[model samples]
Target: MQTNMFKRLKRTTRTALGFACLLIGIVFILLPGPAVIFIPLGLALLSLEYDWAKVWLKKSQKYFRQAAVKADQALHWFGKKLRN
Candidate 1:
């Protein structure tokens, strides 16, 4: 019984925090803040209790990875151009 209560409390806390982060992230999209960081963080927290969040989190991870690769390539190209 104690464990069940603890689990419920934990889930509720997680859900509240997840929603808070997601909402903040959305707000950051319109305003000036770190949406990239918060969105993924919210998704990660929500993913602990929700399947949809998990799916979105995976997609976000892939997109970020691709963006990172492209950014790295661009920097490499810029460095090479400077040398020449």
Candidate 2:
């Protein structure tokens, strides 16, 4: 069926993107930019088929959560005004 063919294509594309993201993440780590950013993304993509990626995604999610919390705290502190 045509629909079946489309599904296969979609899966293939997902797998490819997952690998690409992982490679980009590694490259970013040595060069510049937020390397951690791509790790989660790569894991997310890989998680579609692999169990290991799920674990990695969980870890990456935690890191992002912590970073968000820190950013929120920093913003709140900066927003506070000195009161008499």
Task: Please tell me which predicted candidate would have the highest TM-score against the true structure.
Answer: 1
Candidate that scores best on lDDT: 1
Tens digits of per-residue lDDT for model 1 on 15-66?
8999899999999989999988998999999999999999999999999899
Error of 2 at 71 (Å): 8.0
- Candidate 1: list runs displaced more than 4 Å: none
Residue 48, candidate 1: Cα error in Å is 0.7
Candidate 2 clash pair list: none
Off by over 4 Å in 2: 66-84
lDDT of the candidates, in the order given: 0.95, 0.86
List, in order, the clash count of every candidate structure. Answer: 0, 0
Error of 2 at 21 (Å): 0.9
**Model 2 error, position 30 (Å):** 1.1
TM-score per prediction, in order, is 0.83, 0.67
lDDT of 2 by residue, 28-83 (tens): 98999777878788889889978988998898899889999999998788778433
